[model samples]
Target: MPRAVLRARGALRRALPALLVYAGVRALGIAVLAVWGYWTGKSPHQLLSARWDSLWYARIAEDGYGYTLHLPGGKVHSDLAFFPLLPWLERGLSAVFPLSAGDAGLVVSAVSSLLAAWAVYLIGERLYGRRAGVALVALWAALPVGIVQSMAYSESLFTALAAWSLYAVLTGRWVWAGSFAALAGLTRPVGAAVVLAVWLGVLVALRQGKEHGERGEEAARPALPRMLLGAVLAPLGWLAYFAWVGVRTGGPTGYLDVQGGWGNGFDGGLAFGSFVAQRLFGPAFAAGLGLLVGVGLVLWLYAACVRQRQPLPLLGYAGAVLLLALTAKGYFGSKPRLMMPAFPLLLPLAVAAARARPVRAVLTVSTVVLVSAVYGAFWLNGSGPP
Candidate 1:
């Protein structure tokens, strides 16, 4: 076989353990959901593949967009607020198989989740080691919102693209990084995080080249064109979609206006802070405290990532994702799902786990898996969107 094929086989062999762990953890979650749905007289399939954004994506796939819903209180929701990539994939998948668009979406999400886990592992391994990579995958798989990974939603697809883009940057494959970043941009608004990673990686490279001597600069000159090309490509998909939305709506700020109609905007966290504050004074005080703790933990993780001196790409991506998740004004319940793409925040914990005794690491991950499975089951059975 060729060298590339040999290298790929070797990489898969190394990633197998992490993949297996992720699969097991997710399987446990699905099992819990299945039992809970059965006992609660709900269909697990419906829960995973036909609710909330999944319903919107399936409708978009089947109907080809141009949907508008007038909510009470003068809120105008448009299907265009949902990104196109997931719907496109669902449409294609359904056409190729004997499945409805909704079912096809679940398939798409399942495959994408595994791919995302693989990319997450590769990035951690590239930065630290195999153990750290495995730890990172387990930590990510056991996240409180990990159930969303298996849902027929865009999170898995977006995360796969984003993680691969970050991996491409880490491996110095600028063109690949840009390509994945663009695909990510097409998946969700948070895809901007991956674009930021690619841009930051390029800028950092260019700066390092500047700092080098004349000989080193000459050595770096050949890669400069590709780096520049990658940076240019990073935002094209996002810009293209936004431009298309603008044209379709017949206004320059059409996309922004559409999102605004859904009560989504960047308010620098003021809206989110107020939302939390409101809960704290009511019977929901405990829930408010829990929310505060969650936010604090995420912020602390980012701080730990920074203290560990992560690469600029990881730092920039994490920072951008953090900013967008906390600052965006929308359904507060969606914050955890929005923050799911910021996998780099788990690095500090992953590194610690990798350094710990094997038994301790396994036990901790096992406990987290149990918690996530039970919480996911309970959360899904409730009348709320994940």
Candidate 2:
């Protein structure tokens, strides 16, 4: 075998433990989901790949967008609100293989989840150490909403792109970072976070350059072109689609209007706050408490990230993602899944887990894994993954 091939195999071997942990948690979630599905007389795979937004994506893949659902209440749900990259890949994969678009989506998500774990591990390792990286992957996999990572959804793909893009920024690979950011923009609205992260990192670098005078200029000069190119390229994919939506809907604000039709738009968290308030005062007070705790946990972890002095790119991405997820109108139940791509929030936990005794770490992760699996199964057996 060639040396490069051998080396690649060796690297995979080293990374296998983290990959296996991710796969194990995901498998447990799927197994639980399958059991729930059987009890409910439903298909688990269908639930994963053919329901809610998954169906929307696959429909777009097969039919090439321009579809809309008009309700009796005069609400319009346009396929244009969904991003294009996942469906584009699904369409291409389905055409090249024997799989249906839905199946292709599952395949893409499954592959992307693994790649996401790997990229996440690499970032953790780069910043902290190998053990922290491994722990990070496992913790990410064991998230209550981690099941979405394995579903035929865009989260895994977008996360893979975002993670690698951030990694590229951290490693000074400007063009690759921008390219991945652009692809991420094509994947989800949160792609803007990745784009912002790239530019933020560049700005920080430039500021540091000023602090170093001629020495900094000498170091940053050669890479300046690439950094600028990356910043310019980062938003084009999403911008193109946004412009296309504007043209198709015959108004400059068509995309925003379409989102508004579905009760999705930036409301500065007013709707979300109202929902929480109602629930807190209503019969579901306990449920309201749970929601509040979840949000609190997210906020606390982000604070931890900030205290840990995580890289500017990570902070930028995490902050943007949190802001967007929190501020989005309606779809309150989807907040957890929406926040799943903000993996930087988990770094502090991963660091703590890495320092724990092996037995303790295993027990902690195992307990959470079990809870997550059951939660995922229950979530899917009912109204799932909006």
Candidate 3:
């Protein structure tokens, strides 16, 4: 066999456990969603493939952009607000196969989510150890919004690219890291996090090279040409899309204007703080408390990750994600899903699970998985993530 095939097989063998755990948790989430959807007279398939953002993606896939939705409240929502990569893939897939754009989106989501799980495992294994890798993937898979991974949304695609880009950065694969980061940038606005992380990784390499020391297999600075190329490629996807939007809207800051139409922007978390405070001091005390706790826990976990001295790329990406999630003016319910790509925040929890007694860890994971599954079902069946 070719050496590449052999290495691929070996990698698969090593990742099998993590893959299984990820698959199992995701399957449980989907099953719960399926049962709940049926009981509520809703189709799970429709919920996954045709609701909310999925419909917009499908519309963009079936008909090229030029769509502007005028809300009765005088708000104009443009299709240009969405990045193109997911709809591009959906269109290509639906054209090549006997699939609707929505089905193509679901297929893309399902496959990309598995790729994301694999990349998450590889990252944990690279930074910590094999057991921690398995734990990390499982923890990510059992998040309360885990059902989003199975939805026909760009989160799965963007996450797969971002995680793999981070993994490539850690391994010193400059070109691959930049290429994946570029694709991630094309997937969502949050792709900026991936680009920033890769740039930070490059900076780290440059600093290490100057110090005549290396970490991991990086014994010296990356080749100048490759490093430069990686840096150049990292931001092109986002810049290109933004430039295109600017040209289309005939304004240099067209993208920002589009986001403004949706009432989204960065305000350094002041808006989110007021939002939490209103709930905290209002009739919705319980819900507000839950939001406060959730945000606090996320922040605390990120602090733990930093204290643990995770790789610079991981820290950079997680910090960027957190900043965007907390500061962006949007639905608070989507913050968790927005931060979903910052898997490194779960490193502390994964390490804790790895250090526990086997049975105790299993029980803890099982309990969390059950709760997450039920919550996912209830979430999808209710107001639904915005």
Candidate 4:
């Protein structure tokens, strides 16, 4: 065979496994949701189109915010509860396609998810080896919360932005990282984590350079001006929204109040913890206990971060995600899925698996696939959040 042909074949050989894994996981998730819909006497398309959180996003896409829900306790303000980016994309797509607002959102999410998986592959390949990179991307694409990737949700969009931002940071493209982080902040409140992680990474790199006696002009460091520029740009999206909400509502606390109306306020965890504890110990459902365990796993991940002395980028991102998951009052049941963007938590395990034995790799991948399949089925059956 020609040298070029051999190289091409080798590249395909290396990439095939990851591609297969991604396709299998996604296909399985779709099938499960379809079957569950059939069993529940619901149309799959309707189930997919059902107004849920995605409804709010679709409304924002079609109506451009300015909607409120009145509750018994108080009115829920949703004008700024959701970021504008995804809905904006949905609105733009719907104009060209013969799709409903919700279907448009789902299309955007699904495409973004594929982009996210590719970004994960790029990051892993650069930081680790080709095999490890492939495995990491596959693992992320096939995560147990796989159903979210297909829904008209923000996880895929957020992951696409966050992964690319992190990859830029890893590659020392500080400005690109910051720009993406800012966009991500607009898409989801959790974008703050990416911003913090990037800033921390730059700081660590600078500090280490100074410590290595590479002082003055001799050090190969990014310009302070450029780094600062990126840092300043990263959170502007969220900040702008906050400012707008504050001004319109006549107070800076209006955003928090709006979230509170949905039974989601940050009250120092007393209320949130009690809610979780009751769910874990109550006769409500086993999913509640699952929620508590997920929280505990997050805590354990933080402990692992400390023990591993992981980079500030990873640590900061993980910490921010944990804070949001713990403090957010509403949707205790969806905490696990909501926290899916905290991808840094998987880095340590990815690192370990990269160095594990072949048998270990096989066993780990098998377990992940099986568990993700079951959970995906359960979630799609209307047993959990969409």
Best-performing candidate as measured by TM-score:
1
Q: List the candidates' TM-scores in order.
A: 0.98, 0.96, 0.96, 0.88
Q: Considering lDDT, which of the candidate structures 1 and 3 is the better prediction for this target?
A: 1
Q: Which stretches of candidate 1 lie over 4 Å from their true place?
A: none
lDDT of model number 1: 0.92
lDDT of 2 by residue, 27-144 (tens): 9999999998888899998988989899999999999988989988878888999999999999999999999998999999999999999889888988999899999999999888
Task: Check candidate 3 and list the clashing pairs.
Answer: none
Ranked candidates, highest lDDT first = 1, 2, 3, 4
lDDT head-to-head 2 vs 3, winner: 2
Tens-place lDDT per residue, model 1, 1-386, is 89979987988888999999999999999999999988889999999999999999999999998999998999999999999999999999888899999999999999999999999999999999999999999999989889999999999999999999999898888999999999988999888888999999998887887888787689789999989889989998898889999999999999999999999999999999999998899889999898999999999999999999999999999999999999999898889989999999999999999999999988988999999999999888877798
lDDT of 4 by residue, 239-326 (tens): 8877777897899897776777677766666777788678778796596777677677778877876686756786788788878877
Error of 3 at 181 (Å): 0.3
Tell me the tens digit of each residue's lDDT in model 3 across 265-361: 7888888999999999999999899998998899899999989999888999999999999999866778888988889999999999999999999
Provide C-alpha RMSD values for all models, in order: 1.0, 1.8, 2.0, 4.2
lDDT of 3: 0.90
| Candidate scoring better on TM-score of 3 and 4 | 3
Question: Which stretches of model 3 miss by more than 4 angstroms?
Answer: 213-222
